[model samples]
Target: MEAPALEVVGLGKSFGSVRAVDDLSFRVEPGRVTGFLGPNGSGKTTTLRMLLGLVRPSDGRALVGGHAYAEHPVPGALVGAALEATGFHPGRTGAAHLAAYAPQVGVGRERCREVLEQVGLTAAADRKVGGYSLGMRQHLGLATALLADPPALVLDEPANGLDPEGIVWLRGFLRHLAAQGRTVLVSSHVLGEVQHTVDDVVVIARGSLVHASSLSELAATAGARTYVETPTPERLAELCAERGWTCAPTGAGHEVPDVPAAEVGAAAYAAGLELHQLATRGADLEDVFLRLTGAAA
Candidate 1:
């Protein structure tokens, strides 16, 4: 069967006087990894909870497979979710935890073994979850989510505690899942953190949707800039200012933003400034994200 799209339509939630999520909307389609990004306390978790039916939304609808999570007859088999990684009994072995929840997912112990191996936790299968590192715990949570072989996945901070090697593994693993036509939505507090992992991005701030677009689209709209090093920095900055370009201070030199490298180079050469080094800086996803979500402030 084809994977179903995950949709949030004007979703909102209020906790008495405070609103957690406000009129948010976006879609996650199959065969792509979508990064759900926002700063901490920006209602990312609340929005996800509503979609998973863990929390009720006061205002709109969160749908999986064209139905609310509660409406699905077998939601687990349709959308696998690993919301958090610490929900395990301290004394229970990883394998044992899987065994305990296997019935709830309508899968037996054998399926548990398969998912354990799939998430690279086979060797640590017998180890107590208490002894598992945060990265291992993350893999365990993912293994549990995969137990039912769901077509779409919703993971919150799957890469949060991973080390360098573990992060590389997760990036490849998520891409593989999407390659298999699964709709994958992974949440994080920063866009640059998941910049290379996702095909699309949906960003929110203060409980409201701020930006939603394909990864490439976001990059294209970010407006690449030119970074240049010069001995006469003041002159270059003045030149950039004259041309209406914003020259941000950088470690090596100044970053003339929103202007092409060729244009900057011509202007510098025309002004008789000796260029020590010049390079084009690609779109900085984190910078763009901060500006969009107002987190930079």
Candidate 2:
């Protein structure tokens, strides 16, 4: 099989006594959106920097399009990254910034215009970046990345400061890009937003990968179970306890562990108790994320 569009194998990095990334290994396939998720201080930014060749990996390697990004025949055309949109010169206009990078990467000015339009910044292309809001800066940054029409994209918190409309636009844009047979890796802390956008997810915690799988597989792994509610929570808890089941009391009910809905119904009927509510709670991406990352809600 052909090599993945982006692959990081046993990649490691450190600063002083801090191990920023530890033996990270993953592959981002072509024509898919892979969500890179982690809590704050989880080394995601560090890993993206290493992949883009801004920071050297202390050990192992990061490969883009079957080669190290620095060694690609046309690095900018092979991989485009938007780690920090606001890092550009404030004095330059959006169009100017993209034009400056175009030639260095052998891209033409027409390509720059096309990308600016693609990112919905054509109207404001001449506005100084300093006057741009965080959302506008993000669009400009994306425009720059698309100037080369690269086969892969690496984005860090690309939706950080976007409004609801901008967020919707970004999601559609990413899906469109992936449909064009490009690999898209987006890092975000907004699990709910990304859960509906990405095809797969790689979760990191404490600089280590805790989970990696397709969204459907993740949901299956963290499957839906029944939650029982009753006025007599204490009695329900006692019944569950005698049956070797775990139960936690809520305001007016007990969250029984891993029991079937029908079984719960039968149990309540046998006990001659009125069941106020019993429903199956579907496992969501956010729940899986929290469980894997050990993060508090």
Candidate 3:
């Protein structure tokens, strides 16, 4: 198997008396979208900053292409990162901003145009960044990251402030990049957006790694229980109790644990109970995330 495009080992960071990240470790493989997810102040941004060499880690290491980012001969060629979309000069045009980084990263003017087009920003390439909308700035930031044609990408909240159309475009764009044998690590607080986009996920909370696994595996690990919605929910609960199944009341329904959908249907029918809805509840990524992070859903 190929080596991971990016590897974080026992990474940690502290600010004053507070620990921002605690022994966080994960790997981003090529040709896959790895989601770096956490709630507010969960150290997701701090961790990405350390990986891109923007912030010095208090302990441990973040490696890109098997070497520390600072030690890489051509860091820009190996990794592309966008920590903040608006962290550019207000006076400079979008094209000018990219031109400045191009020479430093050994990327040519033609490559800049290609990336601008790739990110759907070629039409506004000459506009001053200060006048651009939030969505446009995000596109410009993405264009800048791709200027070097790097094999791996580290983006922090790339979809922030984007409209629904822009968000949809970004989803397809990131998937395309990953499909081309590149590793894409995206950090986002929007769990619903990343749930369908990422192949693997790393969830953190309170400066600690909570869970890391493939999307399907994480969902399965959360368990495969069935939810039964019935007009007579109390009767269903009684049936579950008689069968030694764990059942909890949720709103008008009963969340039956360790029971299959077929069994729930059979039980309801045998008990002469009328079920409004009976279906197997597939555990979503958000459910698993909240459970692991000890957060309310």
Candidate 4:
């Protein structure tokens, strides 16, 4: 197997008295999209900063293809990252904006046009950034990241202002990058935002690693469940305890994992309890995400 495109080993960071990222470890392999997930202020940005060598880590290490990010002869060409999308000069045309960075990225001015087209921003290339819509600015940021055609990508909240249609376009674009064997790591606070686009997930909360696994593995771990909504939740709790079944309240309903709908209905009936609603459900991706991160709905 190929070596990981990105790796974090026991990574940690501190801002004086406060801890930011705590003992996190994960690997981003080539040819896949990895979702770096957590709620707001969960150290997602700090972790990314440390990985890019923008912030010094207090402990451990963050590596890009086996070396520290700054160790590469041309780091931008090895790993393209876009941590923010709004720092452009208001008066600069999008094409000129990329042209200024072309020399820094060791690419000629023509590369800017190619990336603008690659990110579907060719039509807007001549427009000043101040007049661009948020989604268009996002596309420009992506174009900038692709300036050198890097084999690895790290994007933070890349879909912040995208409309539904723009989001759909981005999904296809990121998938295309990964299909070409580039490693991709994207961060977001909402699981549903990038759920369909990612192949794996790494979740963190309060600066600590919570869960990290393949998306399919996480789904399989959640298993199947029967969702039941009844007024007498106390009685349903009893039935679950008696059956040695683990259960939890999933908003309006109680989800009994690994238990069939028939079993739950039969148990409620046998106990002479009233069930207003009962149905079989596959594990909900967002529900599992909330549980993994211990985040409130």
Candidate 5:
């Protein structure tokens, strides 16, 4: 069996009096897209830096493939990471920028061009880094990370500058990577996008692990929320008020907290109101994530 791709054991960091990351422990398994999530200032960047050996942890350790990153002879081949998209030299062309990192990972010029094409930047390979748009820089960052064809990937806010089309493309790309038995850990604030991308998640808040589980399990624990659509929304809302159930008007319906569809149907029937639609929504990752982080904060 293969080993866990990424491991964080009692990982922590501090800046003078401030503790950035507390005793955080989690695992990124092989062949899965795990989302590392938290609110702003949640120590996510610090944690990633520690994993990549860019920052020294105040205590604990981070490892890639069962060994400390520093212990790996060629860390780049074990894990490819991009914590930010701002490292390129302004004067270098995209292809040249990638070529610069190729030697560091034991690759060559052809491999650099291959990754440029893999990231769909081949056409603009000669464009100066300074003139590249934010989205293009993101692609270049990904290209640099993939230059070595590592088995694991760690990305932070990778979708930040991408357009809608780019976001869709990245979603498919990450999924393809995970499907190939590669591990992927991504941190992003775009909850909606993450919802569709990641298979599992490890959420942190205030430098502590808040929740870590499969996305399906997180959604399962959110319980159920029911939506009712009626021609007389005001009347139905009035009935809901009498029943002490919170009802908020939606686009063409009203969202009621934790009520079953049958109950909603019965209420409409009792009030002689015609029901247009009655549906129940399960808890989504975004709702659960916000609730967890908000409470922790």
Candidate 6:
């Protein structure tokens, strides 16, 4: 089956006097992982709910392959979602739980076993969900999402209760799903994990879109500042400012915005300023996330 793209256009939701999501718009292209991120109470959940048709939107639309989630003839075949790992019944065994939902998606019992094995949950197939570990429960959630072999996936914090090893496994699994040309959108507050897992990012705060861009672009934009250490800090700062560089004095050294280390070193040497250290203080995704979200607040 061909992979489907996800699009949310001017999506919004409100409850009484509060607006949970406001004019949010973003797209998740096929064959890549797009991370949905925000601070607590930032409407990430509300947005995802609207996307999956679990919540009625006050305005706009959420579409997969040019159709709303529930509009598809076989929505399960179009997209699979695991919004919460605790959705399973405690009394039901893992296999039994999946088997119960298989027919609803037009799959047979065999598909349950296949997904259980794929998620490494075969050994715990008959174990009650109440007896399962958090990681094990997360695995079961993933198995449920994979049951129909859908072309797209929507997961919310799939790594929340995972161990270090489980987190690693999930990263590879999501990447593999995207490699098969499936569109994947995962929401998580763990910016470090999302940094390595996703190809693109959509960040929201206080029910509004704050930023949306590819991971590389965000990193590059955040890392535009370089650090320079010189004995004549004030002199170097003046020199940089005269050259049209925005230079600021930092605790460790001087920060020159958008100036390369090579250029800084050459200019400092020409000005006879002894440099002790000069390097680029490259900003990672965490830096970008914090700055954007903090500003949004």
Deviation in Å, model 6, residue 66 alpha carbon: 1.7
lDDT of 4 at 172: 91
- Residue 258 lDDT in candidate 2: 70
Query: Model 2, residue 64: displacement in angstroms?
Result: 1.0
RMSD of each: 1.7, 2.9, 2.7, 3.8, 1.7, 3.0
**What tens digits encode model 3's per-residue C-alpha lDDT throughout 1-297?**
232388889999999889999899988889999998888789999998888898899999988877788888878877888888769898998888899999878988888888888888889889898988988888888888888888888888999988988888888988998988899999987677778789999899977888888888887877667888887767877888889999888776788866789988897888898988887887655776777777622
Query: What are the per-residue Cα lDDT tens digits for candidate 1 across 75-176?
Result: 888899998987999899999998997776799888989999988999999988999999999999999888899999999989988898888888999999
Best by lDDT: 1
lDDT (Cα, tens digit) per residue for candidate 4, span 103-214: 8779998899999998888898998999998888888888888898889999999999999988888899999889989999999999899988999999999899888999
lDDT of 6 at 101: 84
Comparing 1 with 6 on TM-score, the higher-scoring candidate is: 1
Question: Would you give me the overall lDDT of model 1?
Answer: 0.90
Model 5, CA-based lDDT:
0.87
Ranking by lDDT: 1, 4, 6, 5, 3, 2
Candidate 1 has its poorest 10 consecutive residues by lDDT at 288-297
- Report lDDT (Cα) of residue 292, candidate 3: 73
Candidate 6: clashing pairs of residues: none
C-alpha local distance difference test of each model: 0.90, 0.84, 0.84, 0.89, 0.87, 0.88
TM-scores of all candidate predictions against the true structure: 0.95, 0.89, 0.90, 0.85, 0.95, 0.86
RMSD of 3: 2.7
Model 5: colliding residue pairs: none
Model 2: pairs clashing at backbone N, Cα or C within 3 Å: none
Mind giving the per-residue lDDT tens digits that candidate 6 earns over 13-96?
Answer: 998889999999999999999999988789998898888889999999988888888988888767888888779899999999
